[model samples]
Target: MNNRIKKIENNVQDKNSAAWKKLCDYIDRVAEDGSEEFSPANELGYELFSQIYTLPETISKLKKVKKVSLYGSKLKRIPPEIGQMESLENFVPYTSYSLHWFPYEITECKNLKDSTVSTRALYGNYKNRMSFPDLSQNPVRYSGETVNCSVCRKKMTYDETNQLWISLWVGTDVLPLLANICSEHCKNALPKPPENYIQKAHKGSSTLPQPPDENESFELQIKEYEREQNTINNP
Candidate 1:
C-alpha cells in the first residue's frame, strides 16, 4: 500500500482528469487486488486536490463509459454533469479522501447500480468529522450553472434562514460533495438509499450546523456550514 501511494503521489499528471485517467488505467491493470478500481496512493504530493477540482467538464465527456473508478486523485468535487452519463453502472471512487459528496445530478443516472465511495470524507458521513468546504468561496457564476440541472446549481439566494445545504453519502470510502440539493424529493430519496449502505439521518440545508440534525442519524453528516463570520455570534 505504501508503494502504491508513492506511485500515485509521484505520478500526478497535469492535475486534469486525463492525467487521472492514466492513473486509473494503470490501477486497473496493476492493482494487487485485481479490482478495476483502486485507491489513491502516495504517488501524489502536495495540493493534489487543488489541481483537479475543476476538471468536471472533462470527466463528464466520458458518457459512453459504463464502469468508472478513480482513486487517490485528490478530487474535491464531482461535476453535476456526472449524472449525464446515462450508461453508468458501476462506480469506484474509493480512497479519494478529499471528496465529501456527490451532486444531485447523480440521481439522473437511472441505470446506475454499484458505487464505492469514501464515506468518511462525505459531508454527511459517519461520525461527520471531515472539514466541510466553504461555499462562500465558490464562484457564483460558472459554465455548468446554466446548462446543468437547475435544482442542483447553487445560483440563487434565499432568506438565509430558509437556505439549506443539500448533501449525499454515496460511497463508503470516497464521498464527493455535490453542488447542493434544492428539492423535497432529493431530500426524501436520501433518507433511504436504494442499495448498498444503511441510511443515517442528518440536518438539511434549512437547519443550523451547531445543532446538527435534531431529528435522526445521518449516514454522512454535514457537521459545519460556511458562515460569513468565523464565530457563531457573527455566524
Candidate 2:
C-alpha cells in the first residue's frame, strides 16, 4: 500500500501554486514605504508560501489589509505583532494546515473578526488529535535566526520575554477557522472562538513544528501511522 495520506496531487506545487504566485505578485507591487494600504482589496484571501523569509517585512507594513486568507502555506510560525493591525476585520487562512501556534501579540487587534480556518489544520483539532508540542519551555531567539517563525521585537526583551503569555477570549463561534490562532490574547479578544473545535490553548492540531528536528519527528510519526495501517491490512 502507498504510504501517502491524501496528499494533494494537484498541479499546485508550493512555489508554483496559483495562490502563491498571486500573493507574491500582490506583495511585490507594494510600495514598501508603509504609506500605502499594502494593496487594499475589498476581499483579500488565500496565501501560499514556499518559505517563511518574505513575510515579516511585508506583514510589518500591511497595516491596511482588512481582509486576508491563506491555506497550506509553508509558514511554520506567525508573529504576534500581527495583532497590531487595528483595522483588520476578516481573516481567512482556512487551509494553511502547516501553521501550528500563534504569538501573544494578536490581542492588540481590537477589531478582528471573521476567520476561515481549516479546523483539521490545527494542533489538537479533533480530526488530527496529535499531542500538542510542549511549550512548557518557552522559545528563545526564534527571530533573525530561524525562517519559519520570526519573534517580535517585544519578545526579544531580555528576561521579560519569557514571562510573557497573553491570552484573549475573542468570542464563541464553532468556527474551525478560529483554531488557527495561537495566542491567548487573540483568543480572548475574539467575539468567540469556534465552539465545536478542540479546547482552546490545548495545541489542538495543524502542520508540523518550525524547527528541522521537529519536522523529523513529524516524519517519524507519519511512518508509525503507516505501519499501523499496514498491520490492519495484513490482518
Candidate 3:
C-alpha cells in the first residue's frame, strides 16, 4: 500500500476556466436528461484531470444522477454542493489518491448507499492513517465562499467558524469529513465516529492518537508473546 501522504494541489476552482464550463454543461445535460449515471472522465476523456482539479458547485443540479463515477481522478477536493445531489447513491472515486477528506455536508445525501473510495489514500483509513489538513489555524481552507454551522446549518462568518474532522459512515465508507461549525454546542453535538476510528472531532495533526494498523498491531502481539516466553524460560 502506498501510505505516504500526497502533496495535494490546493488549486481553487476557476469558474471562468474552460474545464469549469465543460463540467457545468455536463451537469446541465444530466439534470435535463435525468441520467442515472454521470461519468465526467468518460464524457470529457482521460485528460479531464489536466483541465480541472475539482468539480463545479453546479453539480448540485444533477438531481436525477444516482451514480457518480470519478475513477482515477486527480481531484483535490469535491464541492460542498455535492450534498445537494439528492438522488446520489453510488459514488465511485477509487484511485483518486490526491482526494483526501470530504465535506461534512455529504451526510445530507440521504439516498447514498454504496461507494468505492481509495481507502489507503483517505485521511483516516483503517489500513493507513493519513494526517488531515489542520483546520484550527485556517478553517476557511475547507469551507466555501460562505461558512455555515455544519450541525445547525446556521450561516456564519469564517471568524466564527470552528473546523474539525470527523470520520462517519458515508455511503458504506467511513470517510473523514470536514465540519465547520459556529459554536461549541454544535461541536459537542456532533455524531460519534465509528469504532477503531478517532472518537472525537480534531484538527489535523500527525501526533493525534489513531488506532494502529494491522501490521503494527501484529508486531505488538509478537512482542508480547516473546516477553511471555522469556518470562517462562527465566522461571
**Residue-level lDDT for 207 in candidate 3:** 60
- Candidate 2 weakest lDDT stretch, 10 residues: 1-10
Which number leads on TM-score? 3
Q: Which lDDT tens digits does candidate 3 get at residues 1-235?
A: 2244434344466668777688778889988999989899888887755567788878888998899999988787887788989999999999997788888999999999999998877887888687665665444354355676788989877777788889999998899998888888999999999998889999876666778776777888999999999999999
For model 3, what is the C-alpha lDDT against the true structure?
0.81
**Per-prediction TM-score:** 0.49, 0.48, 0.88
Q: Write the per-residue lDDT of candidate 2 for residues 1-235, one digit (tens) a residue.
A: 1111222111223455565456555655552533334432222342334433223534645676675555445554555446666677776655556654445445556677676666554443434433344333433233343222123232233333222222234322122221223244534544433343333333321242222233455787899999999999998
Off by over 4 Å in 3: 1-11, 138-144, 225-235
The true-versus-predicted C-alpha distance at residue 36 of model 3, in Å, is: 1.3
| Residue 202 in candidate 3, Cα distance off native in Å | 0.7
* Model with the higher lDDT, candidate 2 or 3: 3
